[model samples]
Target: MATIQFRLRSKANKNVSIKVRLSIDRNNVFELNTGFSINPKDWSETNNLPKQTTPENKLLSSDLKKLDSYIIENLNTDLGKSILIDSNWLESKINDCFSRVVKTDTSLLINHIQHIIDNANTRKVKNKIGLSASTIKNYTLFRNIISEYQKKIKKQIQFIEITKPFVDKFTNWLINTKNYSTNYAGKQLEILKTVCIDAEKNEIQVAPYSKIIQHFRESEKDRYIQTLSFEELELILNVDLSNIEQLNQFKKENPELTKNLSITPESLNNVRNWILLGCEIGQRGGDLLEITRENIRYNGKNYYIDLIQQKTNKSVTIGIIAPHVIDIVENNLPKKIPHQKLNEYAKVICKLAGIVEVVKGTKLNTETNRKELGNYPKYELIASHCFRRSFASNYYKKIPTPILINITGHSKESLFLTYINKREDKDANADLFMQFYEKLNKDKEPQLKIIKSGTND
Candidate 1:
């Protein structure tokens, strides 16, 4: 029979470290650190246990008893005697008892991430049965990044090693070495924290230091968002793409540029209409490109674009408020174009529409393959996402936020506000506040009156 006992290292009035003694007969004996401490006043010399007068003493005694039973049960098993018995082995058993470390392969950080990726489709979010395709893609990318980081450190990340300093090092590496934006690094760290939180929910033990791990604050430069204004949208909507003969003539003259682009007049025309539709509907590019004539529905008095959003699986009915948009939806809904084509052609179309205002934003450098911040023509930054943001920004105060949330599929107002760069629109918001202030005080009389400095008026 194997026996386990806990005792203080040295008797003292102050806190003293506790040690574990394990005996397998008289021939084999082992001592291990218990990672616990207590004062001599709380000890019971006769029983070799803490006195049960205080709650702390009771818990310590209870944990020591559990450790004793746990060790004896394991040592009595055939599996335990097959391996070598040493101080290190006894220390491992003590760690297991206290949950100071995870001993299972399933609890490894990389292995757990693989498990999460494999089961992503079956996992539920809100009311949906699976994560969005984009979300899964991002998770796969983050997994690759974590693998590279592990290689850099020459260590496999353990769930118990995800502490504040570990996350800080990872984030700094992402920003400094990987050339990732602060917000991008923060988002990746958030995903890592999410995995840890999910692991904890499944009864996995992580390091106590992980509780202090937090996301990096978004940098001001990264927080700057660029969206198409109403003027830009109108310019795109009314662009002169009807002159196919002139477009063909220009393409004929610029064969070197047009050869690879395959920019037909019809393609440009289709992209133009798609951009307008996206601005009006405020849906994601994936869902926006799928809109066809069939999505239009008549509600007796008004026409609506009814469809289920692909990412959220939530149905939204966009009421056709603008007469021009309603005209296009009812009669001239453009043929579906490739989402990539929309992204590429959108820049060309906007550039042709004379949207060349210099703006501060991030754009991909082809050589580096990373988005770098610089001043660029607004048209260069225009993409499918710009349309949704444009719709949100253009109609922010004109329409209620909740109604916009329904259309844009955003879960909350704060996220939507942040998405549209509300913090950067202080001047416009100030004008709106001034308008409301005047309206509230329209009929009120002035309270202040001029008086001499020496006189009590």
Candidate 2:
């Protein structure tokens, strides 16, 4: 049997380094660095350990004992019995022992990320619903991008290696090499930070990269949130789908024009009603697409939308107060519509409604594989999310913020305010603020009093 003993190396500048010595049958000896140095006076030759019982010394003693036990445990294994008991074998065992016991090899940055992704694949959010398909897709994409980043750098990194410099280099690679937008790159970094935080909870050291993620900022141009005005909503509602059938007939007669105008009357009517419903209820596309006749509830006098939001898993009741919503609920309404198709038809509906106001927005230029900001027609910016924002923005002051937030599932007041305030029409925002300013000043005007800087004046 091999006996492990703690010993001190030669003292230099009053500091003595500790080493573990393994004696095999009291003949051959092997020394391993404990990677700890202490004051010469703190070493106790009699006890063969540190002299004091301070917290630091106690931890060091515990580590030394753990390392000693690890070696002994391995020596008793079947593989250990087959190998020759010599200094060379003991030295190799030391490396294997640290790798197994201390997790020095398996705790690489990429490995921890893969573990997080694998665990996320099986994670449930509201105890029943698993992670959304899009979420899983994004995580997989992020993992692939990280792997590519590692390949580009030609080295594997540890968790502790994630620092500001690493973030900077990775961000630049995402923007330049991968052609990701600033907002998208920031989102990827946010996901990476989230994974790093999870790794930290599992006792992984990641403090070096925690603060670096906060510095990532998406440009203001990239932060535009599209919303429809009441006029634009009315225009879409009033669009004549009767001509859509004629257009389809025309497309059949002329095949070349089919690509430009390939809409049908039924599809147009379906998306129009869906958009009207979404604008009235202010629900996300996930919940909007799931709506059915079963979701409508009547409380004797009034009707309400009673459904649990799919994204948040929170039950919300939206009163059927809007005239258009009431009409749709009382009349014929589609049981379900594809969310992607709804978004596509919504843009076409907006365009036909003459909602062509120029606005700044980001678009992925497929030719260059990069996101560039340019002036696009207002209809091009219209999406399913715009319906929710339109509801919030149009009725921000008409309804109580708390009540709206309850329906929207926004947890924070500040975030809700920010969401509603992101308007493309500057004049509309100014008008809302002006109304607030007028209301405040209407009650009482401030009486001005002037005082000279010098009392003599």
- Candidate that would win on TM-score: 1
Model 1 alpha-carbon miss at residue 393, Å: 0.9
Quote each prediction's TM-score: 0.71, 0.67
Per-residue lDDT tens digits for candidate 2, residues 215-301, read: 364544447767888888899889787785665664576453234443777767888888888898999987888888898988898
Candidate 1 clashes between residue pairs 3 or more apart in a chain or in different chains: none
For model 1, the stretches where C-alpha displacement exceeds 4 angstroms are 1-102, 217-222, 248-259, 424-457
Give the root-mean-square deviation of each candidate in angstroms: 13.1, 13.5
Report the number of backbone clashes for model 1.
0
**What tens-digit string does per-residue lDDT give for candidate 1 at 1-457?**
6777788878778999888899887999998768778999899988999999999999988988988888877677734569777777787788888777645886788888888889988997877688877888888898999999999999888888888888879888999999997778888888888888878887888877665567775644456576778888788878787687877775787564345565666778778888888888899999998887788888799988889898778899999878778877776788877787778788878877889899888888989889888899888888999999989999998776778999999988778887886754567667877887898999999899877799667
Candidate 2 deviant stretches above 4 angstroms: 1-105, 121-137, 215-222, 244-246, 249-262, 368-370, 422-457
Quote the positional error of residue 94 for candidate 2 in Å: 8.2
Model 2: weakest 10-residue lDDT segment is 253-262
lDDT of candidate model 2 versus the reference? 0.76
Candidate 2 structure, TM-score to reference = 0.67
